[model samples]
Target: MTMYSTDTPVNGQDQEVPPFGTAPIPGSRGEEKRAHLQARRTEDRADRREAAEERRRDREHKRRMKTEAKNAKVGLALQKKAERQKLRAKRRKERAGRLVELREKLSHHMPLWGLPVVLVSLAVGASGQADAALAAGMGWASGGVPILTEGMTLTLAGLTAQAIEQRRPHGWLMRATWATATGAAAINAAGHYIAGVEDGADKALYRAVLYAGASMLGLVLWWIVMRSKRAAISGRSAEETTRWKRLARRHPVLVRRARRVVDNTGLSLPEAYAMVWQRANGAAPGEPSIREIRASRRAAFKRTQAEAWDGRTRFSRTAPAPAVVVPAAVEPEPETVPELASEAAPELIPAPYLPVALAVPGLDGQWIAHRVPVHPLPAWRPCQEPGSETATTRFPQGQEPLPDPSPDASEDEDGTQPDEAQEQVREQVADDRLDKARALVEQAALEGRNLRRHPSNRQMARHLGCRPGTAREYLTQVLAERGIRR
Candidate 1:
């Protein structure tokens, strides 16, 4: 059943060709069907490849869109963070600026040393005392002395500073200082007593501190008294006058009426009178009575100000130009210069050049006389020669000039001699200086550091800026007054 194979070998290759005829053979038909199936498989594979490519493209598009969305979200988050950072930085800058402004405002009112001292004092009072007490294993009662001492010292310092700055006496401050010091001293003594008699260096050190504190307290007292004395000496009349002037400016009508009553009516009135008078008077005593003038002036000023602020005008005029009025020249009255009439002086001296002889102290108990022209009456008496009572008199015995005998003769007789008058003035000044010097010594003593080893006459004189003799005399006087031994 070999049959002739439908294939033949040509050029070493086997070829299968369909048999050509009106009817197709089964093998040929089978071959055709297999070819068609292979072609359909190829088309199916192409379609599948195209569909897979389309799916890949859609997935790539989805991934790209997701990536873009992620990038946009990240960028948006970064922008928000940047904005937040910028806002924070702005707030920080504003806070820093406000802090700087606050510091400047504080610096204006407080002195350079004041704020630091106050902070230190507060810290010490709040923490230091408690810590020290705890470390020492002392109870609150036992620690009271140290607390009071430190607190009172700080308070006194502040009070002293305020008093000096204000140049006035503060009675409450003095009273408080006294109370604190006394209480602290008592507490310290009691604590020491309760602790039993300590021996050795510890005891000595404690005693030394106690003494130092006592000395400081004494000095504080002296300073307070001195400041009070100085304030009293300065007088309150000037302050009263200044206050009156201030009130006059604020309420002219009230002040004017008050001044008239107090000055002319010989009435002893209180400040309430002025307050009542002010309540009664609405405007100044001599100002314009009508309201129309004031309203027009105020409206015009506001309009001009508004225009200037709006940049419509370069300049603003609040007040009208004053009218220039030429005042008539007044003929001055004839002034006659009076001549000094004295029997001792033959020559008539002009009022400006009336020479008065002043005797000044010279070396070796001698007097130096100088002729000074008198302008007006001097407040202080003329200087005199030293030590020889009437050795260098201003006027010769018989050549005494009578100052206007036409006036009261008894008054001239009551007038003191130039030397006596000068002595009185010197004495008064010395007294004041002595009081100030005592105050300074008290201050130095309170500092806990001795200003001078011994408060000698020379040291006292140096501190007082006075002569040694004067210092000695002042000390003697003070001692005598206080009933103290020499």
Candidate 2:
């Protein structure tokens, strides 16, 4: 609130000077100043809000990129999982196909299997009536009885053992028993039907039906026996079954036997010898795995044969040629004619070791080729060093001495046997050298020193002719003697 008086003197002479008044606040003389301040603050706040908004937009953009990256990672994982599933499905399909193929092979082989079952059933029936025929057939098929004796027995035993350990079902014995029973019943029924009675037709029909059923039942019984036995041994349950060993013990010694037969012998006269060995062993469920084992053994046998062959055995069998008529040749003009000048060529002469000799022995000149048999070291064994016993009886006598290698032809031969004598001297020198090496390390070690604690153990080993590990050991021993921590 300001008042001005005409009579008031201000600053000096009154002169009706305007009342002395404080200068009005710049725009706020009425309220404009306060408004200006408020405007300024408002503008500042607006600028800050815009800056914060910009920052928030930047953060949102960064967040979206992070989210997109996460989504991509998840999608890639899913795609990989799908690919893995596809691969597994493909594998499953391949395995299924292979199993089917194996099954098909088995079906074709079933005929071969059927022969034995039928033959066996007939033999069993004949044993009661046609003994001679039974014996003959048995002798022919089994070479008396059983085939592929020991090997087949062993393989089957191994399979059974593995089956027991792995805990699995085996269809082999079951299927075999079933077939045998069916075969036996059919044979019995046929035999009865053939031996017709007074009520011939009705009796024949009845006998045939009964025999077939009996044969089928026989097969079922066989399976029951086998399965029960397996279950007993495997500690499972089917029906009470006895072990083969116990049965063998209870039966006549002559009839007692193992029941395994695997055979892969070829149908040759010589294979008869092999068949003889087959009867003394055991029996398996079906055709023995003899063929596979034989194939493997045959290859090994061939390798041995080839080794024995050298140049003396390997040969190509050629067929004899039929005779042909020859016609006389007419001479041609010198310019157009070509002649084989074999006049200077020598007839092919075979080497003394060669099965067939040739003049142009090899690809080039008739080179003096020598066939040196290098017996390779056995793969299963390590190299036998000097002083070891050789397996062969006719090897070089006494222990073979270690090979004495000289430094080089570095010896001054002097027309004397320098190499041998020098080798002896080197051996002697080496013996003394170790002693000198010991002296150096011994001194270092006395100083309570360890190469390991210092710069290098290799340096110490270099001073010794042995290895770094050895040097460290020696140094450690020395430290132990000195009773030092180093």
Candidate 3:
């Protein structure tokens, strides 16, 4: 610290001055200046603190808004995902139901399938393998006929082939086999319990009789199935067959049947015939009902008609009807006459006379007073004067009046020749005209000219002395003959 000096002089006087940092002597200028500086510094620091706080608040508000927007976006994405999952689940459920229905239908065909199995079992039983099958508890029919087991297995195999041919899903055949096996097991249990016997020979005989009866029953059922299948096949062929050359020559009955099928099925003749042939040969499944087929075809046709070239689909069936624009009713014009006078006068004015037509041959029409007043029709126009512009006559453009035949000219002795010389002249003229027309056609073709325009047709007709239609036809034929495409 420096020492204070109390001996400083000012303005040539002996006044003493205080130290520099000490509070100025009361009423001095330095004391007031120092206090003013202290207040300004404090104000500046306070202003800076307020500005920083405002900036922090502004940053917090922006961060809050950004977080809200992100949350909203995430929520929307999740909602869409949930809706998509719901739609997919619904579709999957519907597909599963259809699959179950299809499997049930396959299961019902088991009896028809058992026919061939029964036949095979009979042969295997005859070969004495029935005993071995029965001992193994795999076959209960006729003391375990080998054919019994083989027939069931064969039927399962046929079901598998049918499934594959029908383009069913992978597990269809497996489901069918399981259903058939269950059915066979049930049959075996029923037979074993019902045909109980004490002696071995009697039991074997009973079993043999039981097996034979079942086989016969299965055969009858098979016949029914075949008959139905035949019907289906025939129906399909009738619709598809339009022309069956071999059938026409060898089987007229089949042709007639095909026509009937066409009428019933509403299919093209060729398609019906093909389907019938497939059914007869057992290469196709049973035909659907006629109603179902027609309904499906109608739906497909509607869809086709409704479709546009663009990928967006317009569902016409569900589309709302267009709103009709009904014009607002106009107020009737006020009567020109005063309301009091119009109400006082009678509304109907009677005619003085009405013209009545007389049917008598010699009588002219006469007018008479009518019992009732007649209202005239709304439209009225003055009659057109004869031979005036309003009464013009229109005719076809190229028409010409025919010449009167001469009474002096008569047919020759054979009654076939009226004018041989004139006929020769006409033929010569026609030949010359054709030659000129050919030249014109060749010239036009070389120039790559189109003859379809009205002016072109008219010009050609004028040059050839023919009607425009005739000229057009000639040009068209020439173009075709020359292999020139339009």
In TM-score terms, which candidate is top?
1
Give TM per candidate: 0.27, 0.22, 0.26
lDDT of 3: 0.53
lDDT per residue (tens digit) for residues 1-486 in model 1: 463332346555543443445464556786787567766877988999999999999999999999999999999999999999999999999999999998864443344445554454344333434444554667766456465675775567557546645655456676776676555444444444334345655674575456435434443545544555445554656566566556668767765656556544555334444343434643222222234234444555555557766333336645555578999999998999998678886885554422334453332224555443323332433585344333332332234432322222343265765455545555666567778666755665677644433356665676666677877776666555545545
Give the Cα-based TM-score of candidate 2 against the true structure: 0.22
Cα RMSD, model 2: 30.9
After superposition on all CA atoms, what RMSD does each candidate show versus the true structure?
30.1, 30.9, 33.5
lDDT for each residue of candidate 2 in 44-93, tens digit (9 for 90 to 100): 88999999999999999999999999999999999999999999999999
* Predicted structure 2: lDDT: 0.47
By TM-score, the candidates rank as 1, 3, 2
Clashes of each: 0, 14, 15
Model 2: how far is 473 from its true place, Å? 72
Where does model 3 exceed 4 Å of error? 1-84, 90-94, 97-223, 236-486
Candidate 1: misplaced stretches above 4 Å? 1-35, 38-42, 69-73, 76-113, 119-486
